[model samples]
Target: MNGTLTTALAAGLGTGLALIVAIGAQNAFVLRQGILREHVAAVVAICALSDVVLIGLGIAGVGGVVRLWPAALTVVAILGSAFLLTYAALAARRALNPSAMPMSENATTRGRRAVAATCLALTWLNPHVYLDTVLMLGSVGNGFGDLRWWFAAGAALGSLLWFTALGYGARLLSGLFTRRRSWRILDGLIAVIMATLGIGMLTNALR
Candidate 1:
């Protein structure tokens, strides 16, 4: 690639990673799935592919359309908040119920379809994803002028790499999570994170 394109790609990579690395509902779900060794591949695939699609749309200037439609985001925010709150309640219940913590992969481990559904909801329903991938990243990519696509490519690659690493690397913590107390702590933290994000979205939508 040319110097300008290369610079754009580098900028895209940094921006993508910086935005995604933060702790959020999606990341929390991915980490829990990784710990349980349940449908990790599918979850990772959904997340990575979702990012690719969103980033592509952003590069195509769909961000402008999003900016024009405030009600669309408000709807998404409401739905996302409901989903996040529901998941948070589940997580909190799990944290309180020791019996819910599975020592081994069992039927209670989420099935592929269920996991896929949750993954899609967590990714698509979250308005923050739109803001980050579609608005922020899209705006940044547009700054690259003719090299915007190159920037999108870099951002997509960043998503692929980060999700792959997070999904797979979480296995290294498998040993640590084998204990019941660990599961409690994990679910508790997830509950807090999810609830906070959900409430924050609800508050933003109300305002």
Candidate 2:
């Protein structure tokens, strides 16, 4: 068990570090929530947990499943596009009504859950994630064919550590969200980002 921990940690940390440092949809959403201090802990947990699940699946050979069902990628692309567009519309609404933020706790919870679920969907549902994390990361981890598991373990741990720190650390800026204008601006930006990403994915799928 101890040895397996080391292997998992190494592989997880190595793979995790590579992707964790990169700027992507999940990180962007997490950072935004952190700044707003809305469900910071939940947001972080979701993001990290999502990564863990993906990485684990990758290591467990789900990458092969993804490879077999290429069309599933298209399905994910479509769903992700719709979700992003919807969220964007909501964000635009928030921009219009700044008070809607604090007064909307249940809404926030729903939004957070939606966002987290989206993050998971976006991360796992995409074939690219499997290609990178599972195929590539797994292959790399097994480099020496001996210490490869160690690499994967490290990668996973890196993701856990990075997401936790990022989500929590971003909350330090919660003070700025106090202003209605700030909320408007932030929400508006989120809307734009989500819409843009969604549209981009849709376009890619169409291509």
Candidate 3:
């Protein structure tokens, strides 16, 4: 009801929307699985649910903990870079292999569980996700003083909307990527994106 609250909400919404645009491993996995029509609902559910949990933690003062332990964040940053680099290398290899097939069927429950586990790892293991969703967003919301809750609400809502749209809509373009060359291009792009993000994180950590 106050100006501070309004500002915080606006800031949170803006930050969430902006960050969601970046295609990370979680988003890529969700989109890829969605396009293949394999466990589409499950993938979207996991992505959205994970965002909700992380965003809620951010609003609950988790950022304060992250800020207090700079060394821990530095370690996370290095580890995240390593993970991203490793993933990028794997993606590059996949691109080089032209025999790859799109995921075509809903996995068994156990297989779905495995995929969920992988998604959880991708969502939580990367320091960038924590830094962006928890520390950065939470810190900014705290700056709203009396209106911090509104900002948190906006951010959470933004994340929910983004994951829903992205995870489902990617299927619309499934036809385009059914070709072998298209898979190669998509994998190549993913590899480049991951490597670039990893290098950027390493640079920031060093500085």
Best by TM-score: 1
Better of 1 and 2 by lDDT: 1
Judging by lDDT against the true structure, name the best candidate: 1
* Model 2 C-alpha RMSD to native: 3.8
Tens-digit per-residue lDDT, 1-207, candidate 3: 767667777788888888877767778877766666667677777767777777777878997788788778677778778877887897798688765435324322336776677667667667777788887887777777767778878887887788778877888988897687887888888789878877887888878
lDDT of 2 by residue, 1-207 (tens): 577656655655655687667765667677776776667787777767766666666666677787788778788888878877887887788789755775445344457666567666656545456667776775666553655556656776787788888888887767876677777787778888878888888898888
Q: Which ten residues in a row have the lowest lDDT in candidate 1?
A: 102-111
Query: What range of 10 consecutive residues in model 2 has the weakest lDDT sum?
Result: 102-111
lDDT measured at residue 86 in model 1 versus the true structure, 0 to 100: 98
Of candidates 3 and 1, the better by TM-score: 1
Higher-lDDT candidate of 1 and 3: 1
lDDT at 106 for candidate 3?
Answer: 32
TM-score of model number 2: 0.78
User: Candidate 3: deviation at residue 192, Å?
Assistant: 1.4
The candidate with the higher lDDT, 2 or 3, is 3
Model 1 residue 133 CA deviation (Å) reads: 0.6
